[model samples]
Target: MITAQNLTKRFGAHTAVDDVSFTIKPGQVTGFLGPNGAGKSTTMRMIMGLDRPTHGSTTVNGRPFGEHTDPMRQAGALLDAKAAHPGRRAADHLRLLAATNGIARSRVDDVLELTGIASVARRRIGGFSLGMHQRLGIAATMLGDPEVLIFDEPVNGLDPEGVHWVRGFAKARAAEGRTVFISSHLMSEMAQTADHIIVLGKGRVLADAPIAQFLGGAGQERTRVRVSDATVLGSILSADGVSITQTDAESLEIAGLPPAHIARRAALENLDLHELTPLNASLEEAYLALTDDATEYRSDRTAVAA
Candidate 1:
């Protein structure tokens, strides 16, 4: 277990984390989410004791990270997958970490096997691809068989299969009663994997809730309607509780009306309907809506492209 209590950090005058608090428990995968400048990496650094917080504190289990005996054996962190010495051999790197922590040398090979990097263990890390580097990072994190694991953007450079593998691996670790905390900007990927979510914006915690609650962000129900004569059918259904928007010449995006009521209304008006589907607010849509104000730099690129 890990708890961040009013964790705040500042660089000079700019406050990065703004009194954030959260608990990550074992036996569940918790996803940490925020936009690019939302202070996620800084928070992770504080948790790993790499960055001194300007105020407040974070702890693993019940003790501050700096106070933990055999810190690597207690909590493993991968802040950046490629944050390794480029000249070091992968196997030697793992061995050095294991040696420093008094973890068994055999554990190095075990993690190598666990992360599927045994074949390339002797290769220089500089020659490794991003996917291979991710594998090495995971191998390093598992060197001590730590009970708490933190991964920041673990899936950033992986292919689809690699993404699936990491998702499964994180879930498996949590199943063994170990805490797994993952941070990523991909909401759809997180929605498929995380049991709970913590959303951040403007260096503050915007929302913290279960995955279901977080995924349901500020959007009303929408229904898709298809008809052969969309013009006539849309006018017929546009009576009171329905505002029909043309999806195409033949399809209608209808909202504020139940499917059954829409069908009944269509039937009474003798309309030819073909399809009816509800367009729920997906995790991606929710994330976009949540960060609408934070995307300042994008407007410039969009305008230039326009």
Candidate 2:
């Protein structure tokens, strides 16, 4: 398991990550999500010990990453695919990593097959496409055969098939009882791949909870009702503390009011209704509502800090 305790960092005067804390349980894929410049990469970098935190720390398997006996064998990470030497062959790069960590050379072939890049392992890194590079990076990470795997935006350039493959690979890693922590800026991808989600914005954690709890627990239980007579529904919903919005000419999106109240109101007023239905918010909707304020754009602010 991975645990972060008050992890924080400041670059000069600007704070990047502010006292963020969370747990990544084993046997599950936990997604890290945030908007652009929301300090996600900074936090991930701190976890990998690439940058020292200004305060607190994050631990993998109850110890700092740098302190591990075999850091690469204990935890493998791909902070950036472009960080590798461009002139080197894919297989040579993996071999160098394995040699540095004292990992067996045979594991190199295993990861090559695992990531589906063995066919192009002889090619130079400069000639690989984004998807191919992603695969090679995964191969490098898996060379250690680590118990903890951290992939940041692993599907950035992958096609639909490659995306599905990476998703399955993440689940397979967890099935082997490894701690799989994947980070991406895409909420849609996270919704499909993550068992739990950690939302961050403006150097702060907005929400950290299970996928079900986040979808079912965070937002209001609102219903979408469609009627032939939107005017009548609008008049009925104008009462105190009752919220309603006109979704279309013949439809109304109602919330903060129960379906029975709407039904009875329509019946008593002698109005004809076409449909009365509840519409629960999806993960995308919940995310937008939660991060509406944390968005980088603001009209009132004099200057944007980030």
Candidate 3:
């Protein structure tokens, strides 16, 4: 497991990470989410010992990353895809890392094949594409076979197939009881891959809970309904706490009332109900709502001249 307690970081006058704290337990995939400049990368860097925290502490498997005798074997991270030298061959880079970490050279081939880059093992790093670079970086992280895996935008340059592979790989690792922590802007992918979520905003943790709880707590549960007498049914359902939005001439989106209650009310009113479907909030919607105020960069939604 990875733990951060009151973790903080500052660069010059600006604080990047502010008193952040969260626990990434094993046996599950925890997604780290935030808007731009929310200090996610900074927190990951602190955990990897790439940058020193100005205050508080972070640990991997109960100790600082640098304190581990075999750091690579304890925790593996893919912070940057271009960390390897451009002059080195893909296989050479892995061999060098393995040699330093006392890992067998055979393990290099295993990871290269595992990441589906074995065919390009002899190629120079400078000639690799962005997707290939990401695969190579994943291969490096796997060379140690660490129990804790930290990936920062692992699918940044991947294709759809690559993204699917990564999602399955993360889940498989977690199934094996390894701690998997991933940071990505792909909400749809995170919704499918992560079992839990940790949201950061304005350099502080805003939400940390299971995916279902996070979504449920971000906004009220909405139900979509269609009936023969939509206008009259909406009027009957409208109340002090209930919200009813007329989506169309025949349908309505409602909140603050259960489906059973709406059905019962419609039955009592003799309204012909065609549909009553609960709308589960998407991760993107929940993230946007929770971090609405924490977003540092806001883009104008005004339409431009055609």
Highest-lDDT candidate = 3
Considering summed lDDT, which 10 consecutive residues are worst modelled in model 1?
292-301
Q: Please, what is the TM-score per model?
A: 0.86, 0.83, 0.93
146-253 per-residue lDDT for model 2 (tens digits): 889999899989999999999999988988999998888667788888999889888899999988888876566677777768877788678776678897877888
Q: For residues 242-267, could you state the per-residue lDDT of candidate 3 as single tens digits? A: 99999887899999998999999999
- How good is model 3 by TM-score? 0.93
Model 3 lDDT at residue 286: 92
Model 2 worst lDDT run, 10 consecutive residues:
297-306
Which regions of candidate 3 deviate over 4 angstroms? 226-232, 246-250, 270-275, 303-306
Clashing pairs in 1: none
**Collision count for each candidate, in order:** 0, 0, 0
Where model 1 places Cα greater than 4 Å from the true spot, the runs are 225-233, 236-242, 246-252, 258-277, 301-305
* lDDT per residue (tens digit) for residues 1-306 in model 1: 999999999899888899999999999999988787889899999999999999899999889989998998889999888888999999998999988899999998999999988999999999999999998999888987889999999998889998999999999999999999999877778978899888878778877888777764457667898877788877876767567799687798887777888788778777777898877777778877887786534546578888
